[model samples]
Target: MNNKPYQRSELIYKDKIKKIKDSNIIIFGLGGVGSVAAESISRNFIKNLTIVDYDIYEVSNLNRQLYSNYDNIGKKKVDVLKENIKKHCKDTNIVARGEKVTDSNIEGFFNINYDYVIDAVDDVKAKLAIIKYCRDNNIPVVSCMGTGNRINPQMLTIDDIFKTFNCPLAKKMRKELKRLGILSLDTVFSKEKPVETVDKKLGSTSFVPGSAGLLLASYVINKIAFEE
Candidate 1:
């Protein structure tokens, strides 16, 4: 077991600290949002983490991704993220899956029995597959909706997907999830109207994605630590 990472958190959460340490969490997507969420969870002494992402970090990702600094631009995302986590939280057990999640392969992804699932992938197909699988299995999950083309960190909030608005990604997801009969979902999303970007490339700022990631991590931590 790893030593408690936050002395102040242990002081307030008390025995919930141990509960956190004992819990297993699996986070999908190692991009701007997922990277920060995964690191935040590790910092809280959650010893077991499963990180999944198929892409390699690119120069463009440095603007928003935590693990995508210039020094490691071409590295596979999950591999670099795993090494970064071990560098900081050495005792935390990390399982890095460097592959995309699809309905065909989703069954293999969930074999670990995670206590919570964080969905941060931008791909709609993969995102829905994860959400549906978690919902069907009765696992707790929090998903992130569209962090791109936005600039306001304060607009972020966690709510059921049906209640979400203003985020175009959330709107599409709401329709698809409803079609699949997945009535409700917990997610972190922004209410800021998306800004138009030059040349059709998505525009994102550091704070928005970073805040969404941390908020998702906070929700998971609170759910496991204080909720039944």
Candidate 2:
């Protein structure tokens, strides 16, 4: 059967396979956008990854979180993400932490060294901490803003954090970061008002956090893979 060393050819091109080999990436959240972002990056075959989150999968997370599933309920998002990535890309290195990122643990969390830092956390304080740390270290970073509402994924755009407007989260972040003298940073936010309903919930079922996470992932991949 066609055994002319054909299978060996597949191995030869292995080295030529363009991947994020040897690059270090840290994602600081494992929720809706963060979980999906982590999964998307892992699929790119990044060499090293560090995911930090203290939350666990819950039924509510199934709505937008990438790693949410009935069987994974109560399991830490970092652990679940790690398992899923290993199943897909065994060659990639991963480090998962079941702890929140804060001022006290920020240094320890990022002390491992990294090429890029992705801020996916929902908490304003934590987001600020990560951004400050990344800026101080001169590491490339991309943050995500309100993805809770908005049905049109096309509305999501990446821009300097200070340039973002309309979105509530971005407005708050801009004010806080500006007060701290952090003028500009990359972020994914919508220019339109996020879709809110009469119920006043953060978002509706159709327009939710997934798109925001995907946008964040796209920015990160572009920055890391293409070095843009």
Candidate 3:
């Protein structure tokens, strides 16, 4: 019997694991950031997770998306991510919705009780909807802005979403949120120049997305386990 006592040792860090396990987290968009964030959070021993995404793994996604693989190219991003989580931690409670985040589904999608939300979608419209809903509900959320174009992952930083200037996506989000009377929120964004694609390829070659995703996950886990 492989009685390594994974469950018992987990109790040694019970207080910490309890804090994370008890919290409910929703991750939107299973793109570069979303995919990586999901993997990072799973390793942190979070008990409950809800992942939302309407995308499937593409050949291009193999570059940065954690769930992308040559064999799973056409698989839904959420499905693969959920499977990966289960493989790592079989006891984890995972709820996956293979649908896009939009105004129509936002309410029902986020209706479940969530302690925190991680915004990893690339679409500005979807990101705005998520931010607004979370802000209104006072649910803590960390959004990723513009991980598309950047080579240096070290330049990524977590800051007040409103304070993220010079980032093209952040600039747009700032204006939109300001118009909605929302002052600030948390975000992971890089100060490095946006990564450019020569032929408008489908995914990013830079390390920014993976780094930003890990950073976002780190912030959420820290807040849930220690700061809370």
Tens digit of lDDT per residue, candidate 2, span 64-124?
A: 7886889999888888889888997787789998987787778888766787888988899
In each prediction, how many residue pairs overlap at the backbone (N, C-alpha, C within less than 3 A)? 0, 0, 3
User: Best by lDDT, which number?
Assistant: 1
Model 1, span 1-228: residue lDDT tens: 645457778888887888888889999998889999988998887868999999998988989898788889889999998898888787788999999999989989887779999999999999999999998899999999998998889998999999998888898999999999999999899988898988978888988999999999999999999987
TM-score winner between 2 and 3, please give it.
3
Q: What are the lDDT figures for the candidates, one per model? A: 0.90, 0.79, 0.82
lDDT of 3 at 209: 86
* Winner by TM-score between candidate 2 and candidate 1: 1
Q: Which pairs clash inside model 2?
A: none
> Which is better, 1 or 3, measured by lDDT?
1
Model 1, C-alpha of 148: deviation from truth (Å)? 0.8
> Candidate 2: lDDT over CA atoms?
0.79
* Candidates arranged by lDDT, highest first: 1, 3, 2
Q: Considering summed lDDT, which 10 consecutive residues are worst modelled in model 1?
A: 1-10
Indicate the TM-score of model 2: 0.87
